[model samples]
Target: MTTTRTVNRAARIVLPGVVAGVLAASALAGSPAHAADEEVPGLHLVTLTGPGTSATPPVTGAPDAQAVLLARQDAVLETIGGPATAYRWTTALNGFAVELTADQVTALESNDDVAAIEANTVRPMAGHVDLSAVRFSRSSDPRASRGAGGSGVVIGFVDSGIAPDSPLFSEVRGLGETRAGFSGTCSPGEGWPASTCNRKVVGAGWWVEGFGPDRIRSSESLSALDVVGHGTQVASVAAGNSDVSVLMNGRTMTSFSGVAPQAKVAPYKACWAAPDPADDGCSTADLVSAIDQATADGVDVLNVAVAGPTTTDTVERALLGAAEADIVVVGAAGNGRSAFAAHASPWVTTVGAARGNTLRGRVSVVGGPAFTGASRSRRQLGPVALVLGADVAADGAPTEDARRCLPGSLDARQVAGRAVACLRGGIGRVDKSEAVALADGVAMVLVNDRPGALVDDFHTVPTVQLSVADGTRLTRWMKRHDRTTVRLAGVGIEKDASEAARWSAPGDDRASLLKPDVVALGEGVLGAVPDAWALFSGTSAASARASGVAALLRAKHGHWSASVVRSVLTTTARPLAGTSTLVQGAGRVRASLPRPGLALDIAPTRYRDALEDVSWEDLNVSSIIMRGGGTTTRRVTNLGTRAEYFSVSARGFVRHRVRTTPVALRLGPGESASVRITVTGGGNPSRFDDGWIVWRGARGSHTRIPVAISR
Candidate 1:
């Protein structure tokens, strides 16, 4: 677990002119970017590495010259020529100074000798979805609830592109549909292209010369618009409108709602076949251009439902690339009744769907294989806590809404200390503030938000996110039955199952690391969905709800980084009270947590040196092969001058097995990139054995070092 992180100048090698500038700056104090006035020289921060090969040259011929010492970065090499093998003279020319333009820097990196490059800085998510505990926090509309989709946050739904103006959904008419094409399978013919969209109009595709695998489109792509309703459903969950109404029972009833109702949603549309009885989504190439387009636009959170199988290498790169540009990439954990860890990468947050997203929850507790007869009863003995904020109004006034909905658990004269409900719904201190206000006299308050979604909370006393259905019933039953002693005890279901939700995709990405981050109302959680209102579902909603909490946390820890948000959310998540490890990763996400230490300056042990000369060192393994059989020994060199660590992880390989201990790695001074991989040399060399060697750390970057393990 040793990784080399690139440190800022002083640790990095300083190039010539930079050295002169530094000398000049030293000559007149310590300012470089602007020191030319008082006899001081203007210095720039930079790093240089090699495997270099240019027809021309650099400010310094051999990248390892003294001029490289002034950049003030570190000692690890950032760029390289190709994957290094034993005895390949891998040198990390770091901490150099240069006067090169952004383009010049690119050209210098073009050399055949640069292996990997490290950066001095990193991007931190502050006003956006913390990809880590990403709960869809809700926002009060000046009307309903405030969760993750805060009023100002911009979450872009960039799929086959959003048909915002489509006639199919121009005015909201149920769901839309698409026509299926033919030409399925992995291949077509000798001269035919492996295009997911075939020229034919058959169920699978047009007539192929011979026969091959078939072709299909996304459920939303059935016709063109979201005829099938996947896209719109996802959108609604992210930012839907919520409205409350009274049910026939004369009892107050609520419906499912989106995480954020007013947060502007931009749809980057693309066209792909959905998964059905006959096919899965299209190839990876189909979405690459779309992702690139989104990145360029600098979108914040990106929801991807039609993710490729863990087997798709190109697709993985696309995911990594999106992260490099600061895009929060999210997707559904496959529906495969299986599990893996690939999706749990620090850069990506994988979500699962709750079978029922209805705000009017219809919770089902599966009895032993046979026991079908169980009596249903109202919960009693608990303080009736009302949910406040945006889960109640516009701008997330859950507390206000809670108060207005039911002045008191009992009549005002009898309602001395009733429990108030709260969630991390986005309106800053709304959830906690609401709870505290409600728990005025009573001893405790029921947390009405999902602990499994986001960690937004104000610990005024006691609370947790009970199922909306459970909470409502518990609160109402208490006011009706418990006149004297409030029963925190109710006959209801707590998260009591080992089954993964349907929207949760199954996993097989041991390389990427996958797991059910958590679960929440995704199917039809009632609330708001834009224009008017509708029930929304999906982990997206959960995250939106979580976002609501995050907003509160943001207020609590104004200086905290995205990692901090994730750390608190995951660490505080209630461990699943079940048997299997699949249903909930660390447990359901919790809304309240005792502050970690006192200072919000979170330095998660895993992030000791998040941005530095990232490299994989001391890698050793064995293998047995024949003719084309052999092991590729890749030696990563920290050409940078600093002594730190960087991120080291790889993915998307067929028979070529890959593994990295500790997930994160640290590298010392003068380190080298080394990996003793035992790969079989018995595949179609161009495809199977050829996989991408990714190096991602500081620079908000990712490098796909294509390696021919069998060359």
Candidate 2:
């Protein structure tokens, strides 16, 4: 019903200045490079580029490279004023995460081999799915038919800790074997026992300081248990037990299951619990430690549901090492309506939020059009008197207050026997309905102030929400006629539902890469939480659903690399009906058996600069000036056994003319060919022009590559 403009609050990232005077004083004194522990408190991630260091190493387990880099790091520390001992995490990129003083930071930055110095920023934790739709659980699906259900696959979660006692983490629900590839261990402390590491959860560890004996325990104890509940919820969504039922407000909803119910979990608690259980609090050092451990443990997938700035060099380097090891790393695009740092890196499979299948009450006017809205109430209200909120409110208050149906603004005597029509804005939708009920109104009708926006709300009384167009019509009719009426209808369960949530992070990333590789059910997703099950929302929930799909794919195609899994998910996704690629990426993920046909093993590279010289790994297009053109190349391989023919075409607006050098191609089995696409803009670039380059195979298989042009 009423349209409301959603405002996204961007999280700010600020790095403090290093004190130059302290460094100068230390250097002038020729101070013995050992400083007292009480120097500087903040942590910093420092990266070095030297003889043996590489950003993308060929091998994941390059102990030699790590050793060489660590030696260099030790030498640098010996030269700088070092503390007696420092808490540090080293990655393959020759990067070290450590707390340092201003003098130490200045010395490190000035080192001959040091490449970059950045602050250790915190990333906020940001999943569910119907397994059948993604082919993971369908009876005929190969993986499902073989009873794989992600058996033998290890999916790692780097987030808040998990609840080891939950039935979802029982060995009976998992592979019931400690994966031989894993070499990690659980730290026994607080309420967590040594038994926490089992066949189901093969590894459990937490990296938070001040967890020693003398500290007062907060909501999240100094243990590997999930006091915050987010980690447990996400873990269950990705790989919970089979035949699970979630308790929603005292009632049990049955037949619930995770995408990969049999996949073993490796819980790495990098995030600490905050005062608010929903919010995430962890440092870059903690995340780097978790990544390094997960990579060393040799897990198949790393599902990081955290969102934040990607400038943390140590975390990115560690993730690159994980990717080199062929781990499927999934991350959440930020909840903010802008580019998110954590998901901005190309190595991570970023996920955005989408609506899931859930039952909601539908509302319609007695004599007007049916409006798009949702309510939690199951009871229907018959025809009742329709009264505008402003017409029945107390005097002396601003008109806006009555329009918003603010508490105490409505007149109790005038609205006692009618359904008050209130405009949407200023107050919470549920709170507005409660205000109407407080004024003795039998029911409430909420109209959207903006056009085309329909919001779902929970009400304390019989209520119906309407879009701006319908609300305008209802309000006009009520003013012209003395006795206008409306009806609220209760719709039973409906299935296969989907919508691009307004809160889902937008993909206006700085690098111009199409963000949110794909979307999945994130809103009101029912999953495991602590001892019971609860509903969770946000991009974090969406990432869990995608992670489960990845595990299933890994179980079926153990030989396929992480890139191939990402390619299949993105290319085969179902595009949302009315949304652009920027909002929904390749669309909602659909699970189906991989077909043998033309498949692009890799998407086009996204570049950072307009020249497109530097390789932007996961980006599709670098940059496009208005009325200017650009060309990018992509390689397509024939996965089919026989030779196949494919025709290429573009979908979306006509402002940009896209052409392929070879409009059609014929490729033999396992043959690969590169296709060059030239895009020419016809008009000035006002905003991003979104489209897709689709390959249609003669055998009915198809794949798509999302492309965009922006100023």
Best by lDDT: 2
Model 1 lDDT, full chain set: 0.33
lDDT at position 412, candidate 1: 29
lDDT of 2 at 543: 86
Model 1, 655: alpha-carbon shift in Å?
Answer: 33
Tell me the tens digit of each residue's lDDT in model 2 across 1-711: 110111111112224322110000011111111111111246666655532222235476666766666777787678765443334444324556566777777776567666566665444556221111110111111112112378878898988889877767766633645446667777787889887777778888887641122222366667678866778889988887676444322343245567887888888887765554323355566777787778777888898876654332445556766765667788876554534323555567777777665445554556765654555556778677778888887867676798889888998888887788899767666568878888988888888786532333335576666667767877777777877777777675444434776666666523435667888777666666665555566677888888898888888777676767777777777777767666677788764445645555533121112112223532332111122457777787776678889898888755788888788999898798878888886587655576778888889878777776655
Each model's backbone clash number: 216, 12
lDDT of 2 at 534: 53
Instruction: Output the worst ten-in-a-row residue range by lDDT, candidate 1.
Output: 19-28
